[model samples]
Each structure stands twice: as C-alpha cells, then as structure tokens.
Target: MRFATYELDGSVHAGVVSDDGLHTLPSGTTVLDLVRAGLPAALTAGSAALTGPPTPLDLARLLPPLTPPTIRDFVAFEEHVEGVVASVSGGSGVPAEWYEAPTFYFTNPYALIGAHDDVPVPPGSRLLDFELEVAAVVGRDGSSLTPAQASDAIFGYTVFNDWSARDLQRREMKVGLGPAKGKDSATTLGPWLVTADELAPFHDEDGFLALDMRVSVNGVEVGHDLLSNMGWPFAELVSYASRGTWVRAGDVLGSGTCGNGGCLAELWGRRGEQDPPALRPGDVVEMTVEGIGTIRNRVVPGIELPPVRAARSRTRAR
Candidate 1:
C-alpha cells in the first residue's frame, strides 16, 4: 500500500492511494501516524475516511510524507564511497572501518521539503548538487537489533534527494570534522511512501530489494543504478544505526547516494577533474526509484544567512 501526506481543502491528511483516488484517514493523522500504528493492518481496517473522488495526484500538494522524527543517512554503496574518497582524499581506498559497519551522520530534520517544492541554493554555495537516494522510515522503537530483526522495523520506502553544497562541504571536511553547514541546508523526501510488503516481489537472492534508481537534472539523465548493488544492505544499515540508541518510529534512514554516477562529485572524479555542472536557479531535479515514485524539485536562490564561522571564532576566543 502507498501512503502519503497531502494537502486537500487547505488541510494536511494522511491516506492510501487507491485506483479511484486518495483515501484519507482522520483529520490531523499523518503518514508517520500510519507507520507508527503499523501499515497493512492499519490500512486494511478501513478506519481512515476516504476523501471525495480520488484526488488527482497533480492536484494534491505533497509534503515530506511526514517530517521525520529523526534522520540518519548511511553510505552503504561501496562504489559511491570509493568515488567520494578518491575525489576528496586524493587516492585513499575505502576506509577499513566502513567495511566493519555502516557509517552514517544525522542531518537536520527541519530542512525537509516535499515533492515539487522549491530548493533554495544555499548562500555562498556555487557548486550545488543533489545526491540521488532511497530512504526507509522506521515503524517502531528498537535498539541493538541484529540485521534480520532490524529488517522488520522498516515501515516503508521512498525516494530521497540529499541536496548538497559541494564547495561548502569540501571546506569543512578539511578541518577534519565533517559536513555541517555544507549539508544542513535542505533534503527532499517524497512523492509517496511505498509499504515494504509491496516490494516482496522484487527481492533478490540475498533478500535485498532489486529496484532501479535514476536521476535527471533539467530533463537530462545524469545517473542510473540498481539498488541491489549496495555493498551493505538496508537491514545492516538499520541494525548499525540502532546500536546503543533507540530507533524510533518516524526515524528516516537514507541509502545515501547510489553508485553509477549518483552525484556530480563522482562524475567529476571519473572525468579527470573536469568541472562538473552545478545546479542553478530554475533547474529541475527529478529522482525516481522503481518501486517508489518520482520527487521533482526546482532550485531557487536563497539569501545568505549570517556567517557561522565568525560566531564560532568569537566563542573560541572567550
């Protein structure tokens, strides 16, 4: 079943997408509510009220499914890791620790945007880019789970675009910490959420979903890859993420960027340092995963916020 958080009659409602149209649940209940309540059964119970005629998708203004309770993005694709390291670190191979477990970072959850929303290019970032990815929403609170058990916690899947400020990110990484101001701008996560049960038909021998992912910028295809190629499966990433901390319902775990030229950094590395194109105002980014649908966003220029560096410098002196 596909669940969505959409706007109708100026109110946001959660519901399942049926052949006829949008079947809405109670007012104020959200997509996150259904996932927290559990899918399939919650949806099959016929409790949520079906809104008027099937609301045409185009007419329904979408949100980010629901503003996640928390967001963790992992680098589960080896090709992507290798390309990123090569581009930034010059010649280092994949980090040894990455092979031991899934490595990830928590991002600002408040910066989320929905399908067809406008993404403002961060101030001071000339090299803005998008990371094409897939994300899983957690259904229940859990901790210290084995990979197999963690798989059950996944509520569903959706397309994710982790918007990036390459120039800002590169500058921060030089300080030996990580992407902070560089990445805290905006992340997109919608179109619709597809329940995990809907993807049983696409599981591979290893039980990993074999969905295809593609990305286009301004109608030009830039990347394509099969999700089955991920070096670390979603279960392992979730298991790793839940270690020592609670993975609550509505938590989002992104698949990071896919391989096969998922981001411009990888493209630039492979192309011998040729300047890769940066997203400019009015550029449309459309990312699609086979099981989930597409999330299309337009880039808009945003004004600069005050310099964080100057503020930190003053604190350091005191």
Candidate 2:
C-alpha cells in the first residue's frame, strides 16, 4: 500500500492512496501511528487502503513519506563506495577491506521536505547536488537483529533526495564528524511509502519491477540509473545495518547515494577539481524512481550562510 501525509485547508492528514482517491488515515494518525499499532496489522490495513481511498492523489500534493523518529543513512552501495574511494585516492579499485560492513550517519529527521517543495539554496554552497536513493522505514523496534530477521522489521520504502552541498561536505568530513553540516541542511522525501509486501516482488532480478531513476535541472536530464543495478541489495543493507544496533519503527534508513555519477559530484566531475556545474536560482531538480514515483524541488538561491564552520564548532564546544 502507498501511504502519505498531506495538508488540505491548512491541516495535515494521513491516508492511503487508491485508484479512487486518497482515503484520509485520521486527523491525529500518521504512518508512524500505524507502526505503533502493530506492523503486521498495519501492513494488512495499508494494503487494503491502497486502491480504496475515496480521495484523489491529484487533490493532494505529496508529503515526505513519514515523519520519522530518526533518520540514518548507510553506505551500502559498493559501486558508489568504489567510485568515491577511487576518486578520492586516485585509485582504480576499492580495497577489499572497505566492503566488510556498512557505514552510516544520522540526519535530522525534522529537516525533511516533501515532494514538490522548493529546496532552499543554502548560503555558501556554490555546488549543490542530488543523490537518488531508496530509504527503508523501520518497523518492529529491536536491537542486534540478525540479517534473517531484518526483513520483517522493515516497514516500507521511499525515494529519497539526499540534497547536498558538495563543497562543505568535502571540507568538514576532513574533521571526521561529518558529512554533517554539509548534509544537514535539507533532505527531500515523499510522495508516499510503498509497504514491503507491495514491493516484495521487486526483489527479483530482471527487475521486472524496475524503478527507473531520473534527475533533471530546469527540465534537463542530468543523472539517471536503475534500481536493479545497485551493487548492494536492500535486504543486505538492512541486515548489515542492524547487526549491532537498535532501529525502531518510523526510523528511515537511507540507501546511501546511488552510483557515483547519479549525484552531482560525479555528474559534473567535482572530484577531478576542474569545474563542476553549480546550480543558480530558479534551477529546479526533479528525481524519479521507478515504482516509487517522482519528487520535484526548485532551487532558489539564498544569501550565503557563511559556510557555517565556526558556528558548528561553537555549537559542538558548548
């Protein structure tokens, strides 16, 4: 089932997507609310709601899939990792050791924007980029789950735009705390989330359920990829990620930046340090993942926010 959060007449409502329309979930309920209600039952109900809603998707502009409790993104794609390592170290291949486990970081869940929202052009980021990815919604809170059990613990999947400020990330990651400030500004998500069962058949190869990924700026195609090409599968990411920690319901685990070229860094060859294209005001970027759907964000440049370096340090020191 596809579930979403939306505002009509200035009120936020949750509901299921149906051929007929969107059936309002409830005034006080959210996707998280259903998670707390019991994942199994929630799954069943979400399934029923998909094609039964009385409201139309056209009447509702999409909202981010969930108001997650916490959002964590993991480096689960080997292709992206290899590309990054090669680009960073000037090597052609990844060390065998790099693929041993998953590397993840937390993002502010409160900062997420919805589909069709305008992404603010953060100050000082001459280089802005997009990462097309799939994020898993956690369900059935638990700790140290083995890979075998990770499947049932998942709630669903959604398309994610891990909006980035490439220049800042490069500078701050050198300190070892981030990709934080560079990453924290904004992360766009939504339309709605597709429950696991609804997307399970996609697990097969040939990607009969193929999700075509596309990105455009001012309606120009820039980055594109396919879901089946991912070096690491969704199940592997979740299982590897949950090995030693607790991931609760409403938690969104990102699939990391898709293949290197799928984001601005590689798209414009930012690593080679020549000159990568930087977006200007009125530049709109749209990301669409097959099956899941599309998210369009317009970029309106903001007066530079001063790189946020010392401010972050002062905040850290306090």
Candidate 3:
C-alpha cells in the first residue's frame, strides 16, 4: 500500500492511498508509527479499522513521508562516481576503496522538505543542482545486520532528491572534510512511501530493483537510468550502514544518484564542461521512479548570510 502524510484543513493526517481516496489511518498515527509496527501488520489490520471518511488525494498537501531520524546517502552507482569524479577532480575512475564496500555520509535530517515544496538556493551558492535517487526507510532497529536481515528491516521506499550546491561543495571538500553546508540546505522526499512488498516484483535475483528512474527540469526531461545498474544494492547499503551501529526505524538510506545524467554535475563531467546551466530560481525539478511515484520541487532565492571568516591558528610552534 502507498502510505502518505498530508495536510488537510490546516491539520496533518496519515493515511493509505487508494483509487477512491486516501483512507485515514487511526487518529494520531503517523507514517513512522506504521513503520515501527511493520507494513505487514498494518496491511493485516487494514483500512477497515479507520475511523473517518477518506480524503481525496488531490485535496491534501503532501509532506515528507516521515521526518527521518538519520539520513545516510550512498554512492552505489559506479557510473555516477566516475562521471562526478571526472567533473570535479579531472579524474576518470572511482577510488578502489569504493569497490570494497558501500560508503555513505550523513546528511542533515532537519533540512528535509516535502515533494512539492519550494527549495531555496543555499546561501552563497551559485551552482545549485539536484540529484535523482531513491531512499529506503528502515522499519526496525538493528546493528551488525547481514544483507538479508537488512532487506527484511526495510519497510518502504520513497523518491529522494538530494539537492546540492556544487560550488560550495567544491570549496569545502578542499579542506578534506565536508560536503556539509553545501548539502545541508534542503532535501526532498515524498509524494508518498511505497511499501517494500509492493516493489517485490521489480527485484532481481541479485537483489537489485530494476525500476526505471527519471528526472526533469521545468518539464523538460534531463536524465534517465535504471536502479538495477548500481554497483551495490540497497540491502548492502543498509547492511554496511548497520555495521557496529544501529539503524533504527525512520532512518533513511539513499540509493545515491543513478547514472546517465542523474544530476547536472554528471552531465558536466561527461561533457568536460566547467560551466553548464545550473538550477536557478523558478526552475522546477521532478524525479520519478517506477512503482515509487514522483516528487516535484521548485527552486527559489535563498536568504544570504554574512560570510564566515577563517579562524586564527592557536597551536603554531607551541
């Protein structure tokens, strides 16, 4: 079932999407509640237990599926890594360490926005970009999990747009530490969450989901690729994420950007161009994955802040 959280009459509600409308779940039940309970149980309980009338899907304003407790985004697609590396560093190949395991970095959970929300250009950024990806939401808490266990722990999937500020990211990484402020501006997740069972038919024997992924800018198609092309699967991403640490319910694991023009950086990288058009105010970005649905967001001007100054070194020759 496709589960959603939406605002109606100035109040937020969580429900199951259906042909007729969105069937409201029990009062006070958030998507996180259902994730914690497990989708199978929620399905078994069914909408028959709902206390109110269904709300028309179009009438409600959608919100992020849930506020993730933690957001770990991984670069599981080698093609994307190859292209981005070439664009950023003039490198033509991925690092060997990338092949040894699925690597991820934590993004700010507080920076999330809804499917159709306006994405403000991050302050001091000129090269704004959007990344086309999918994210898996954890259903239960687990640490040191195997791949199979990680698969079982996934409750659902959602369309994820990892908005980026390329120019800022470039400067910060020179310090060898971050994509921090560059990436912390905003992230988009929604339309709704598709339970894992609903996507089972798309899974291959090797565990990769053969879903079609696409992205568009201002109604013009920009990129397309298959989710199955990833070097590592979502289960492996989650499993690696769980090594020596807990992945709790509501923690989101991203599939990273797909190849073949998944983002503007990749496009620039492939063309060996340093300056291509980047996302600007009023540009709309829409990302879609078969079975999981779509998320569309519009870019807007950001509030500029005073520039940060370098800190004085205190431990020189002491």
Ranked by lDDT from best down, the candidates are 3, 1, 2
lDDT of each: 0.83, 0.73, 0.89
Name the top lDDT candidate: 3
Model 3 CA deviation exceeding 4 Å by range? 49-52, 274-276, 313-318
Q: Report the lDDT tens digits of candidate 1 across residue range 138-210.
A: 8888999888888988888889899989889888888888778788999998888888888879888896889
Tens-place lDDT per residue, model 3, 77-175, is: 998999988876567889999898888899999998998999999989989999999999999999999999999999999999999998888888788
Please give the TM-score that candidate 2 achieves against the real structure: 0.86
Model 1 spans with C-alpha error above 4 angstroms = 45-52, 306-318
Going through the candidates in order, what is the number of backbone clashes in each? 1, 8, 0
Range of the 10 consecutive residues with the lowest summed lDDT in candidate 2? 305-314
What would the TM-scores of all predictions be? 0.93, 0.86, 0.96
Better model by TM-score, 1 or 2? Answer: 1
